[model samples]
Target: MNTFAHIKPIAQYNKVSYYSVCIEGNEISLFEEFITHHTSTNKKKLNHVLDWIKLIGNKYGAQSHLFRPEGETADASALPPKGIERKPHYTEYGKKKANNIRLYCLRANENVVFLFNGDIKTAHYAQDCPNVRKHFKLANKLTKAIDSAFANKDIVWNDDCTEIDCEDDFKLQF
Candidate 1:
């Protein structure tokens, strides 16, 4: 079993510093992969998605959005939020429409988040999009892996929740 830990600070905004994680054998972190792949593929749309992430990290901290209603995407009270229902240990972060690139992450702690993967959604629900569906399935599997890591003491957090002590080769199995 492998573990997860904060590797290094990737970005900082408004006093909040975002860290990156690397599963053993991978040179780039999951966050780096998302930015690189998504930006290269669709700069205009994914830019907004990335900006939203930065804004959230700056204004209310990395975990602020998690405090909102689990399924609520915006302030609209009449219409339901687009996208599929998120599962335990996973949260979707991104805007709608062209900005509908959703990044699924695991809340390792109050201020620590481990981004697993993302998908571009083109429907009212993620299940309607093959790509989004695949990412969602991957997120579920990663969630289970994280759970098992915790159970086996493969993942451990520092007292302040600002850091983690993880074993090598922490990559997701499937």
Candidate 2:
């Protein structure tokens, strides 16, 4: 069976255009599902991750240093990077912390990011973690499909490489 996902625009910030995927037949986008699932159980961590996303989208852009590489392939990454700490009186500061919550995504460029779904990773490796195994695999598959779309000119970067241009009904199959 083939799985399909459509690129759904989430937010357009000054530095980047944030996006998420809506899989065929699903009511909510993957990123929305991720937020809903973790909202109650991991509120604080979720906030931290959101803060990071806001900072990237509004101020910093999707810089390479912000994402934690996730997949074996080069495309997938996660948010709320390791070693980041939440200080009481300062902006997001740095300190070692084991963040189990993973939100897999693709940092398309400094100006575009595609948010995917993820879960609490219980193991060191995504494939070994029961909770995040499917998410990780799905992220990788979607990443590859999106990459191919770009390669085939189905998805083209806008001028300045800050955004992408594609048909409104463009869908990726994996």
Candidate 3:
């Protein structure tokens, strides 16, 4: 399986720290790449996303709507853009928008979230859209890889769950 080579600290606030997923040989993270691409191509939408992140970090900490389940039910019927089912291992974080954007993250713990990837919602149902489906598939793959890394001790969290320490050679196997 592919493992992540590094867990780069991306942001920290209110004693909560956020991280980016980096694979071996990649200087920039998947999250950074997403930001860069969206910033240049879709500045307005990207601004909304960044603002949402800032609000989550500065105001809510771990209790923000961004980190919460998209729906109250397992099938996420509470929200229409349903793609992946909400589980403890992985969940979708998104800000409601006319042009919806969703970020997938792995729940490392109560206090830590690792951003894997995201997508732009163009339809009422995510499964009906090709890009949304592709994004969810990627999220699922990353979720498995992360779970394996956790099982193997490649990813370890500090005592207070304030930091994550990963293996230097860790890279996503998929």
Candidate 4:
């Protein structure tokens, strides 16, 4: 179990991406606690990310899909190319090219928390982001404290339609 899974740090804003991190204990409801606690100061940052995720989840969950475990096959049906099945795809208006987006969901005691809305091209190195990596280390330490509690769990797809609105102010470091 990678301790990184426990780290659920809320996202900081940028022109292009939305991100969050967490490194809490793997107790039954720890995942829920992390998201509930670390909301972006600015609601927009929060809502934007949440809405983007909901947008795609709603798109796919409305259909028959497969949820593949992380360590097994990267069976991402929603994204383009489809995990090594990379190819050029076209959208309805030809406005957006079909690039693969990897929205991987992590499961913690059935909550299936940690919503990432990045594409395959970007996701390839998401786990290595400097900000994310810092919390990743923190989550690692937390997992060590908990005797590495993530040994047993299954990844699942979540489409609960989470709604987050933009905030007046948002802060990244606390």
Candidate 5:
């Protein structure tokens, strides 16, 4: 079955531009849905992931070292790798120990990234985790489709390669 989706920019910073996928007929993007779903059950992990996203977008510039490869067939990755610990100084929340939340994405380049959906990984591997299995599969599929789009010139890079240039109505099928 063919699934249709579109890319929309959710956030833009001086260093990187973050885009998210919105499936056909869906009001919220996959990334947004991930945030909403985890807000109640995984607030700390969610905040940690969000903080990294902001840092990557505003300061770090989507560095490859910040993401963990998750794609089986494409160049997709997941954020907040396992065993990463950070102390959240912004809130009264204590140190961020081990975060199981995995937000899959495509690190298009130093300046571009595509944020996708994810869930709390209950098992050691995403394939073995019931919570993240579907999301992992969907993210890989979309990543492959987006990769093809780039190869076919459907998605082009800006002159400086700091951003992507695509039609507003451009739709991707996966």
Candidate 6:
């Protein structure tokens, strides 16, 4: 009861972040930052991206719990240990196509998170550097949104346990 009361707002906020990301590389540090909250905000576009993040993160509880990145793309953090499926999707970049690109989710703490891509088709063209950034950024938002929603509901987010899965993770499992 206490947990759901605490996290209800987080879910509302995360629902927004999930929609905030449309362009590539705009939302990466979001999901990861929620848990570690250590992203550096080093990118020139930090203001808009960070604003979106904080607005959503605040719904959970506090921002300090999240892992802040020194730079948006400084390093690639593997998805959280809570097992979820990675569904391969395609994106196109210039002349390159990133194939079987996984559009998937991660359970970061209590967050109900996942990634998105523009590669609805012709994935081979999705290999451009821009595509990578876009993917990472969108992935960030999905992650943050997930984090915000699940706030104190980690068990619910993970079906590998008895708690019934919530929102989208139950469907995302591959």
Candidate 1 lDDT over residue span 1-174, tens digit each: 544433544665563445555555666876687778887786765665565556555665555434222133321110012333421111325432323667666555545555645666677665567766655555555656666666777767667656565655454343
Off by over 4 Å in 3: 1-6, 68-99
Better of 1 and 3 by TM-score: 3
Per-residue lDDT of model 3, residues 86-165, tens digit only: 21112225533343566656556546667655666666555665655665556566667667777888787788876778
Off by over 4 Å in 2: 71-74, 85-96
Score candidate 1 by lDDT.
0.53
Candidate 6 deviant stretches above 4 angstroms: 1-115, 118-128, 152-164, 167-174
Model 5 per-residue lDDT tens digits across residues 1-174: 888999988899989999999999996999999999999988977998898888888887988888877645545789875444442332334543567789999899999999999998898778889999999988888989999999999999999888888888999999
lDDT of 2: 0.84
Put the candidates in TM-score order, highest first: 5, 2, 3, 1, 4, 6
Query: lDDT for model 6, on a 0 to 1 scale?
Result: 0.32
Candidate 4 global TM-score: 0.28
Q: For candidate 2, give the lDDT of residue 87.
A: 26
* Model 3 local distance difference test score: 0.57
Runs off by more than 4 Å, candidate 5? 71-74, 82-96
Work out the TM-score per prediction. 0.63, 0.89, 0.70, 0.28, 0.90, 0.27
Better of 3 and 4 by lDDT: 3
**Most accurate candidate by TM-score:** 5
lDDT of 6 by residue, 1-174 (tens): 111111121232432222222223233333333323223322322232334344534454222223223134432122211112211112234332223222223334333333233221223232344434465454544555445545655425334321234543222110
